[model samples]
Target chain A: MQGMSPIVKNMTRLVAGFIVLFGVYIVLYGHMTPGGGFAGGVILAGGLALVVLAFGEEFARKALTHEAAKTADSIGAMLFLLIALLGYAGGVFFTNLLPVGEVGKLFSAGIIAPCNIAIGIKVGAGLFGVFVALAVFRRAGAGSSTGMIEG
Target chain B: MDPVLLLLLVLLGFMLAGSLIAVETRDLLSSVICVGAVGFGTSLVFLLLGAPDLALTQVVVEILVLVVLVRVVITRRDETHATSRATLPVGLVLLALGVMAAIVFGTLATGEDEGLTMRPFGDPLLNEQAEASVMAPAGEKAPEGAPARMPKSAGGAFLAHGLSESQGSRGTGAANYVMGILLDYRAYDTLGEATVVFVAVLGVYAVLRKVGRSRHAGNESDR
Candidate 1:
């Protein structure tokens, strides 16, 4: 699909970076702040969706392919499960096995940070994959029923 | 009522109005936008309730929902699918409302006076009592080794003792109580939620991929 107007493309180029950075910030600081993995992941997906909206489907596919998204989604899920399983070494499932440093600091939370990261990755990739799939399906539907609907 | 409560009431009113408009509107795009407005208003309500975490989640989820729904609506050419038959839906809604009302009234009728009456906003008596109970010295133990009984109010106990080193119990090391509860104390539940999300995404992928492949096979067969 062709992209939007030059204005929108230019605006997206300028704004998408900051949007992504903000999402990352939210994900990283989730343990201390209000925003967590889920919220930040959705925000990250939104930033990417903005790029898809501005630059169109073809450009988005090039930047973030379906295969890559699927891989990332699986990797994220595996990482989360790995973290949970790792807790078994500490004598219980999903236990906070790592050392809990001083409270109120960024790295103080033992397993929470890693858990948040895993969740963020999983949610972000999963959402983007869904969007791509929907878009591709829509394009295919349009192709098959083009003249049938118009006439 | 406090000014904050008044403001919250106004926001709730707008939320209701937006939802009503969203349901009543025939134009798909307008309906989606109205639903988004309602979602945004709900986030504001969460903020007013002093739950910034919930507010953030609500806003981001709303954005994602808006994007996906708008994409779906825009892709389909058949936007005028509004039917005049509203009896079944209306009746179902009324039934649900009746159930909710009955539950609320039943709780109010059967609940004890102490349980029914909420503490005044920003009351500190509960916190003080919780601190006294949990922070007591070892010498104040009742019998053999059992410590003094703690406060019945879980919220008060958490607020008073969950952050710092109390009598013999070590508080959850995390500064954020919500994170502590979700990730540390109840990590299994969180894992379950994550699994649910993963399954949902997988379902979407499977359904879409199947449709695409079937469509392709149909085109090839026609040739």
Candidate 2:
């Protein structure tokens, strides 16, 4: 936790930026690539984790919190599930409620990509929330009566 | 047996094994990990079967479930090992029975459903006439008994025709079409699913929010 040099900090920042960008790329090109919401979300979370690791947990918590992230994550998940359920009222479960556009085009896959984006946001935020909450409870002396024991 | 069928069986075996481990493992973390492995295997099988959409959905759901489970595990008071049931012999027999039943049902179902085939006759005169009616730019009445290449709705007729051609040309619609059918033809079902998600999020929020409020109250009293 000590002696983190300036060069190491800069390198970490650069890698984090790349990881976040790559995650975005994967989510956007989900229809054509092996990477989609899950892969992209984790990649995005990894970027956030790098920042927390290099800078500090306090800084990360300030940027993203469990309370706020929890809301957005819920919204994203709700939207996807809602879309799936809409199919049932139409006489089937998980039916497409919207018209399918030209295949292979960016807007062609109906709501699939939008659903993917929602999932990506939910997952990224959820993972970050987990890590930050743990850090706060354990290292930040924020949760529980068993405070840090000074050796 | 077809190579694809054989491969599917192997994958299913792997999934069953992982799920059994997940259920039988005493350690919570290991069980979670095993459950994730099962999800990953199922997703892979979906991908192989040309259902990329389902695969994507499965993977995303798995990640979400895992994240929630991990969070709960982290917050819980008890971090010790859980008890594993001591019925290995019974478990194996049940597993075998389940697997056999699944395979038998799957094969029987597949055999029962013969896919859509072209009509007995070649393209009827109605089809040709319908094609002409479709090609007619605008302000045209299609002849009687025409194949009705396009829908009656002028606004969406062109779009519908284009969609059918694109989707029917290749068999790729198994995935893409599912999404279309899910949202459009079954909008109501989607509403329920969304509600479930909303409810789940609300439940999680309520718990986490309560935790925060109690902690905040505790801090105030300490002050």
What digit string (tens of lDDT, one per residue) describes model 1 on residues A1-151? 5778999999999999999999998888888888878888888888988888788878866787778888988998899899999989988888777777777778867888898899899899898888877766456556555322222
- Model 2, residue A137: displacement in angstroms? 6.4
Stretches of candidate 2 off by over 4 Å are A1-19, A22-56, A67-103, A107-151, B60-175, B182-192, B210-212, B215-223
Candidate 2 global CA lDDT score: 0.58
Worst 10 residues of 2 chain A by lDDT: A142-151
Question: Residue-wise lDDT of candidate 2 within B77-153, one digit each (tens)?
Answer: 56665555566598899998999887656553433234543322211222222343664347844433335564443
Residue-wise C-alpha lDDT for candidate 1, range B10-115, written one tens digit per residue: 8867988899899888898999999999999989988877789899999988998898889778767775867887466878999998996675455335234657
DockQ of each: 0.48, 0.16
Docking model 2 quality class? incorrect
Q: What is the C-alpha RMSD of each candidate to the true structure, in Å?
A: 5.6, 10.4
What lDDT would each prediction earn against the true structure? Answer: 0.75, 0.58
Model 1 alpha-carbon drift over 4 Å, by segment: A145-151, B86-157, B163-172, B210-212, B216-223
